[model samples]
Target: MKEYIVTKHAIQRAVERLGQTEQHAPHHLKQLMQTAFYQGETPGPNGFIRKFYDHFKTKTRLVVIGEKIITVYKFPEAVPIPFADEVAQVIKRKFAKSERDFKRKERALSIEIAEFNVELAQHRLSYAKAKSPKVRESLSDKISELETKVGRIQFELDEAIKAFNAIKEGAAKYL
Candidate 1:
């Protein structure tokens, strides 16, 4: 793994440009620098590298020389992108919609499981109160069937939740 060192001057510059306090600047700057070093694209020549970061709604640029962060400053102007922002917005909306759909499905499955449990409980009560053996046997079968339904629905809910979590993890990188 490549390690990039964050200098005191870079931290101070990030604190000033990004409106972060001195106390929290070092850690935050280090994290941002590390992320930039790994994830950010270098826009300049091989010897010169610039990393653009958005911090506190302010676009900033970090100057890195080899393994040392030389300084950080507010970006003077917007980086030109004709349709990249629009495409990103569309992709974000799609992710949001998928997340909402998964949540809705999970809720629906949970409600269904609860309703099955309630029906099972009612059947159990009926079984206990019945006097005839025929009715008791029938109720016992019904309760077993309801329990199976509940178990199946519960498994589905668990799978849906796992899928939702996976989507969230995948979306975090972009959003």
Candidate 2:
């Protein structure tokens, strides 16, 4: 997390540049206050504009300068917050609404995996039924094909799991 800070060095530099505290106060102090007093969405919330967000904050700190509340503005610092987890299911569910593109894909992949498993079972049964060299060879080939398809599906599943975990961890760190 980063913090907004105006150090002693910065004040000293400002004083040196302006040559007089009174002169600096009249010219720049008001502008700085106006900038800081703004109540609106910052860059932190990406969906700030989309939703009905009504969070308001007031930042007022007293400074002992000529015995007055000289409103000051400093650049803000930012830190990220985790909005949600279970992002994998969220993405898959989003596919339901926007199904024109990927609905067929989702169905096809599931169907293919189911068919692959059924074919593997059927081939094993055939090998048991016909105890011959050619039958065994054919069953072996079919089993190999099913295994390949399952391997591909396994790789895709691993990737999805990794992506989900990475997103969770990365969002935990920062946005």
Candidate 3:
């Protein structure tokens, strides 16, 4: 038993060192695989894979930028736990990209709304400055257009806020 334990430790160190340049993150998850296998349960690749995700998730990053750019767990893989961990890393990267996309969309939405409001204000000023009835009427139509755009963006922002809240709540489970 002692020799087995020693061998496992040695293998873990060796593997970690071997992967150093490729991945700075330590393989703390390997410990769980070692303990479970040492007990003779003979966990197969799939079982060890589960432990790997759970371990890697808790020790490292599990929650990736899920579907909507919020942090969520990576997908499960069929390989060993280490494989799952690698997948989790990929998920994390995907999450980052998704998060950036979401932020970009949000910022664009905000800017659009701001621009609409500014247009509305400008139209109102134009309506006031109009010297002729036809020009005032035209300004009124433009103001109405701006108002409609503002309403549409407001609805979209509200929906996004709801989605963000749900994602935030769901993220609490992983943390």
Candidate 4:
């Protein structure tokens, strides 16, 4: 078992804060050590002071001087933030809508790319069977243009999908 050497100043402070007497101070200090949740640390005159919150949300600051508890006191007027959960819900909804929009754009781009591929294939068949050089050249140019369009659309679709994935990852942290 770990033993804590409680300081005299710490006892007086705890007694004054809890409206208790000197005799009750040791029990109060024991309870504070047992039930407190670690809040954080603060800079003290000597060094760093460790802070904790008890069951009633009372902030207790204790400084460790060697093996002893140096100073213990309640930090003044700490309050929990309001509407944190509600703000999180609002952010989740906004990110969901953003994900949906990106997915929709990706679907539209994919459909356009599929159509361009089909058109390019048909133009290639026409270019192969054309009797005149002029008709074959025209069909070849059309096929090239369609191919470029398909490539651009496919690139845009990939970008949109990447955006959706990024949004999903970001929203997971909050929601």
Strongest candidate by lDDT: 1
Q: Output the better candidate (3/4) by lDDT.
A: 4
Q: Write the per-residue lDDT of candidate 3 for residues 1-175, one digit (tens) a residue.
A: 2111223333344345333222322233233333332111234444432112233423321211111111112234556565666776666665566567667878999999998888888889879988999999888888888898899998997787677666556544433
* Residue 57, candidate 4: alpha-carbon lDDT: 56
Q: For each candidate, what TM-score against the reference?
A: 0.51, 0.38, 0.45, 0.54
Score residue 173 of candidate 1 by CA lDDT.
69
Q: List ranges where model 1 is wrong by over 4 Å.
A: 1-84
Tens digit of per-residue lDDT, candidate 4, span 1-175: 4566778887887677766688877676766666666555566675655544344455566555545665676666758559878978988889878977887887788888888888888898898889999999899889889988888888888877887788788878766
Best by TM-score: 4
Off by over 4 Å in 3: 1-95
Lowest-scoring 10 consecutive residues by lDDT in candidate 4?
Answer: 48-57
TM-score of 1: 0.51
Better model by TM-score: candidate 2 vs candidate 4: 4
lDDT of 4 at 158: 81
- Writing each residue's lDDT as its tens digit, candidate 2 over 71-96 gives 23332445543554456456556544
The lDDT values for all models are 0.77, 0.50, 0.52, 0.74
Cα lDDT of candidate 2 equals 0.50
TM-score, predicted candidate 3 vs. hidden true structure? 0.45
Ranking by TM-score: 4, 1, 3, 2
What are the clashing pairs of model 2? Answer: none
Candidate 3, poorest ten consecutive residues by summed lDDT: 63-72
